[model samples]
Target: MAHEVPGTELNINTTSNDQSAEVGNAGGVASAGTVQAPVGTASVSRKRQGSPLEAENPWVIDIIREATSKQIHEELKASFLRGEPDMSAATVFFAEVNQKIQKANDEHGAERDRGTIPGDAYEKLYADFKTALEKAKLERNEEAALYVVQETHSKFAKFNQEHHLPEEWNINPDAFKHDSMPEVAPKPEPQDNDSLFSGSLPDYTGSETDIPDNVSTLEELEREARYNQSLSAGEVLYWWKRGVGTQTFVQYGQGSSKTYRIRAGSYEVYDPESVPRILSSGALSGDPSSVSCQGKQKLQYRNEKGRIEEAWAYTRDQVRGIVGVGWKVDDDDEEGIEPLDLLVPEPYATYPHTRILVLWVDGAVTLEDRAFIRRITKGSYLNVARIIYHKALRQEIRYRKAERLPYEHLLDRMPTRAKEKQDIELGDEEYEQDGEELNSVEEVQPEYRGSVQASTIRSASTRPPSNHGRSRTSEVRFVEPALEPRRPTSERGTARPSPNRVPHKSVDIEDPRDAKIRWLEEQLEMSLNRNHQSSYDSSSRWRRYNRYDGRQSEVSEYTPEPRRRRRAVHRERVWDNWTGSWVTARRVY
Candidate 1:
């Protein structure tokens, strides 16, 4: 008799014929229905067992199907009278199911290697498995969900080992586990907005006796005491007035000894006891009008005509409509052969409010100007005074150089007035010519104006002037020997020639302008050579597009061809295998 296993297909044979019955008789337990097998002697022949996952067990199949549907129940019946399924049985069933899924993934990988599956097939499979795992989680089948997560992670690991994929492609089992757990809403935190202070408050029993008599209440007395204690050493009081924020003169030391000016709104730290008498007399005032103006007094200085003149000095603030104070050439004073064109004229009706006096004498600022400025500003505005003095000095120096004054040689390297004016006029002409070309070109294509202007300016700056059929004298002005400054004594020695200094010229022999023009021509020739070489190289590179049959071709003007007619033709060419020749069988239009 053979009895089948309850949950599996395997059968157990209890019928004994020879060896198993003799062994059962020796053991004193011989029975017709039940017989023990002898040691080392097999009674029933069973098939070789492989992995449990490879077996076609009925209970495994039923549990896997139930897990897939997420409808697992305790009283569910399995095939072949299998015992009631529990969590252990479900775990085993899911394990086998996971093995099957892995085997299917291996098949998919093989198909991918063979190029029979789509590139995203693995992705689709992963998404479907994830969906099933989520459904199991929602149905409260934790065992199936856990197995799904395990299989997904294992597949990810295999993919990483084989394909060397990025870490982002791997599945995070912890994330899914966290997602399956129940989520509790966060608790609200308590807020306290009633109190302004953080710790405990101090006790006040109204028994304090150290309060000042001037303060009426204890709070006011405490405030006064705190204010007094906050003052730094050497400071009796800090004073600041509201709304009167302009700069004002303040006297702080003993009468007429030390005094200074400070802005009104800013704080002033001083000892009031030191100047109590002055404070009592109310000498301090923030009014701008109260300050004395030293500019009202008239000062005397020698004029350019060797005569003393009286002029009133003024501070910078007193002047209105005055652009600046500097030496300027007089347009009317041109009677003398070497007329004193430079002068510091008196303030006229056009600028009547102007009062700052700028006096020039012997190609420099007069001593009277410095003395007057020092008297007006005392020592506070010396920097401003220095700046004004330098402005006047620079103007005078520039005027002298322009006029070719006798003392021009004493100055350092300076460009001649004619050379500077020529350079300026040339630059202006080049800029205007470039601008005209730029405007004309921009009329045709406005988008490329910026680039064209940049290239044009760069070329104009480096291009040498064309002198074809043009007189050199017209382009280069000749400066007379009388106008040239005398050479200094220091340059007469055997000293090395300076790179910046122009060569010394003989007084009666050669003209200096000839040498200058020759040097300029040499420089221009060198630049022209460089420009020609570069242009030749660039033209050679561009000539590649203008070649025809390996030979250079001239570019011609573009002309449109005249339109004539339109024609349509159809022809059939067939190969004659018998004659081995192509024949036109038919022609149609």
Candidate 2:
């Protein structure tokens, strides 16, 4: 027997013993089906001569097939003649389908537990099984019809043999039915459960008149774009295409939801970071004006003239004025674009005295404007532009209000020195030696502002005496000294008056020990006064009582001179010849 070509009416025949073969043509139909007896199980050669695609294929599998009408008729006739077939002889098509589905499901479950499947292949496999099961039923029923026809024929053949019935009786099984009997139509087999993915095709029906194309006349595209060009700012426009998800986004509360038609396969994809809530024009796709960015975003657009036009920042509710009160993100916009939470402009104290400068600025106050400031600072042209644009805005916003240093720019401009105490009373000679006193007021020098210093300029007369004051101390200052001509070193030696010696010639000189005692006394007096002030200022009584101060209070402007204590103890010295000690020379109270 020869094997037949699967779909076409072509047959190839060859005997295992006979190498040569004859090509038979029964109306160009293959003779394989008519050949009887196996030709020793000869293998069919799949070699094709012409096409590369067909040449290498070793197996040909047919996906879908149905019984032809003639085949169906023959099957019915055969089934009638055979009548009821032995249940064992009737073949069960796809008998292992359920087991295969269960096994696949078990494997799929295990894979799901192991997390190896890319998608839910189990569902697809199950669906496929259901589909295969239905196809198998069709094949089985078509094959079973032959047996039904065999049974019918046998029933009529018995009558033909017994009573010489006519041929019409075989063809028409219900020919002898009573007049009152109801004629019945074959019960229809259930069609395979409509495929799980039986979705209607997307309707892309529209006419050129619907959206009279723009640039139907323009030769090339240009940047001259307007916001309200396509659909008016608030108008609704629906759209769809193959790859891109269906329809322009719509805020459902608006009438656009009901007004527009929804075609099949519409979807919105969401992604954070990369995807903004309302994408501005020229962001991810198309021209800026093609889609409204929810109208809440502040976008810079160009008019027909090409000048950049800015829209003031808008509130979400305010955006409703453009897209209608229903202005909101799509239901699928969860991942797409989130709502905005503008950062409050809080000046971070990154720079020294930044808060003070910000306070000095008329209105600048928050960290919120940092991004805006940075953007402005990033000039399209040059870094110098960053300085100008942002600097101008900063000045407008009063970001850095540090005025021209408030004084002259000095050489060492960055130093910040502590303020020196003022108002100490000083005698004239000391002043004359240190530097010349200003005879009149002087203007602040530019160099002073630059760096030299901010010297405390309090008036001497206005300074108050300290609590321990013996003679009032002179107030100290750090002002720039007036320029004076320097004396020659040769002359400086003789011309420079010695601080301790008198200007005139003198023979007697003060003992060095006496100078030390004088200095020690001054230090002791200052220390005593400091202790007294501290004891008074301290809140703890124990600290005050423990001060151990034994000195006189100075006549300060704040306090009158205290009365001197009685001389209860006097210093007396007696020479101890054996110990060699002088008691009178000791420091005594």
Candidate 3:
């Protein structure tokens, strides 16, 4: 059958093997329906000329544009109206019409998967066509829908292989499993209740249970136990489970009741070499099920690696300033009363030296409150009194008025200069002499002044009569009596006349009149006689003596000594001159 194209009014060939093979025109109207028999199964061609991306085929576009609206309407009904619709009959109808259209249009995404329709088409077919198949199955065409499902899978397979798509694109083989599928083994049955609970807890082979022997000694552990008044969390748990003694008690107080599972055992407490294991215990987490003694609740404990460990536990309210004060309990005041009893007290019963008790007494009291409690409360019944006393005890006390001055104050009061000079033995004698010199110089200056004037008068008297004659030496003291000479200047000042200037005998003396003069006189006399004898002997003896003489005499006729060749101004300059850079210098005697 053929139909007219819209807008162009062209007629195109449309009849194919099945009546379903009728095309809709450019008017976009659907084809008439008709029933047809299924075609023989066909394998998809491995060779794809390229994907059906064809606006390339002129024939396909012409066919779509020429077929009329009425023709498409008749074809669609004819394809499904037959006994039962199958893959070949349905595919052939759409193939001759829509396939050619898809091949011609790039926008249809025909190239997206080889041999398969685009995603929109696949979705549209699944919804629309699947619905129709379901309708057919309801109308006694169940075989038709099953056949369509198989064909859909086959089409999808062809699409994956032709496109070289990823393995994930392939349909899962498990989905298609039939009678040939393998069976899986069944899971083991759970054990009975008695068997499960009857089993003993496994021994902790994963880690060692016993603390190392090297951790601490028994004595150290005891000391720590007494000091801290408790055991460690691990030790507490350990003892509770396996220690020598275990006790149980139900405590009632503070508007609540708790059960204590107490354990007693000797635990090593001090490990000087190990890092302190401060624990928060169950008390910190507010578990209310367990209590730990000798533990730092909410405190940081460093291991050897300096990491804060989470494995150990302790209480949160055991801090010193916060003890008995910070913990939250039922029926407690918003501002809690200072607890009379320590909910968690120090392990050691004895109080610390620095502790002091502060008591608060309420006005209201009953006989029972006074009597039965009096027996227990007369002393420090509540640990709080003892703890407060122990925590606040004073070490020393002194009355304000009786107290001695502080060391710094005593130092400040001392005479600084006097104390510094006390060790100086040289100072006492010096001050005495300094005083005497000052007094003598002050009081005796006039007498010394009078003596100086008298000496001037004597010196004036002894001066020469004004005749230009050489003055005779007069003894006059120019300096003090301490500096005056013992002898007169006329006899002692002049050097004694020596016969020779150079004396044979050496005499050292400050005054020229001493032994130097006598030695020089003896040398001069011997020299004079010897000179006379030598002069008389003369010529022959002189020649012979000259031959024997090694010492050369200096030339006596005042022969000018050959001028020493002056070091060429500067020896350093000679080298400089050789290098063409001589420096000038002044002549020196």
Candidate 4:
């Protein structure tokens, strides 16, 4: 029991502690009062030096924190696993003992049967133990009360000594009270108007409380700051330029679909008993293409093992510091956890919630959502628009389920668990009989099989219907087999003429080599005859001139070699000996 502090209604058995502890419990540490570490941070004990209250009585807080932590751990574990203590047997045993005690009591210090302890003896021992436990508890509470009393008395004594009244005046209760009717104000002596500007109407032109056109109350101003668009000076224009934006957190499967608001350096210590500093911010930007960390800051958290950890603390600008080089060019795909500049404080429009708002992680916030969470007493569900930045288009696409066509949605609303075809391969088939087997499909011959060099020519032919309503069969129609046998791969030249082909007759039937010899002989003969005719004509001319004047007549300017073409000895041109006495053609080997 703790000594009660005056003027404070503090309860030691506080159940509604904090949400950071809730997050920790979800992580399996098991304390609802546990202060949460920052996102991506571990909790440590050293983080509490920043707190003045805990620094004074750390030991007391730690003791309570340990017990509560254990309690919450067990409770949450039971809740999750649905485990319960085995109390039935214990209760039954207790009842039996109580019955035995009662029976002994009814017997007046004697057992009804032999070999039994007397009721008086059993009752005395049990009652003594019970009384001792009750006494201990009572003494504890009394001690706590005594401490409270002492502290209260000491404070009052100190205060009284410092600012005490006269003993005679303060000793009596009636000293501070009115003993008689309060003295009434006496009537002023009859007098003429002594006031300045007398008989003149006072200037009351602008003193009247005339309501202004833009009359706004303090509450209305706060509502505007937190719930409505800004109505303050220059803020509306600033917001419009900033554009409407929302945030979303995607922590794999842990997203609660709830938004949060956090601030930087709220100085929340990371202890099981400390309040959690949320990992949220008021960062928003109409331009998805750009993020600005104009103002933001970082905070720290601790863990049970008492280690310090850090994370992106909080920021006012909504861009989440994406504009910072850390996010724009990190080594990894994630923009990652990095501190961003905090936003400047505003007068009234303050967001009040867990500042665990994460963009693209968990805790999504939408511009369409109310500016302030606490003031939102009523709401109608609105479409949640997710913004996707199309880098190539340099544009942001705002998409929501409500904007989709009905046909765009999938017919299967449930998740699909794909199974390999190998698993349960015959799930669809029914077993008609234990030994029955499926009919095997007909196998085609290798000849009928398609290949690179050949293909089975498919042909259709009508057949009479079977006895059934309609019948179908994959029948091979009569396709003419090729008449020509396939050429032997071993043969080098073209195929021999077909035996069925009629032979065409020609006058010459000589082998190609013999034909070549004969054709060359004929060509040589024709050339010789033409050469002989020319020679004869020249001789005739020469004889006519020379016969009349013997040797005196000179042969006209032409000379001729004695030539009858040599008998054709060879057909092809070949090289003759360079030094041969006579030039001669030789047949090619």
The 0-to-1 C-alpha lDDT of every candidate, in the order given, reads 0.36, 0.30, 0.32, 0.29
Scored by Cα lDDT, where does model 2 land?
0.30
Worst 10 residues of 2 by lDDT: 351-360
Taking the tens digit of each residue's C-alpha lDDT, what string does model 3 give over 297-389?
235678999999663232212112211111212232213222212221233332211111111122111111111221322233443432232
- Error in Å for residue 25 of model 1: 99
Give the residue spans of candidate 4 off by over 4 A: 1-210, 217-222, 228-276, 279-589
- Predicted candidate 1 versus true structure: per-residue lDDT over 1-589, tens digit per residue: 1111222122222212222221222343234322222232243222112323223222222223223332222222231013112324434443444454344334333221221112343455466666888688677777778888788767756653332222333455676776653343457898867667745665455567754445498667776664564342112211223343422223222211111122232333333334221121222334333212243456899999999999875543442211123221123122432211122121220111111322222112111233444443424343333334333333334334434444232221112244433533333443233221111111111132234444223233222223232121211223553323355547565434466866565456668899899999999998744422222223465566765322222332332233435766777899999999999876544
Better of 3 and 4 by lDDT: 3
lDDT of 2 by residue, 471-547 (tens): 32222326653332254447435444555754443345789999999999999998766634533333465455776
**What is the number of backbone collisions in each predicted candidate, taken in the order shown?**
0, 44, 45, 30
Candidate 2: which stretches are off by over 4 Å? 1-82, 87-233, 236-243, 246-589
Instruction: Point out where model 1 deviates above 4 Å.
Output: 1-199, 207-245, 248-291, 297-589
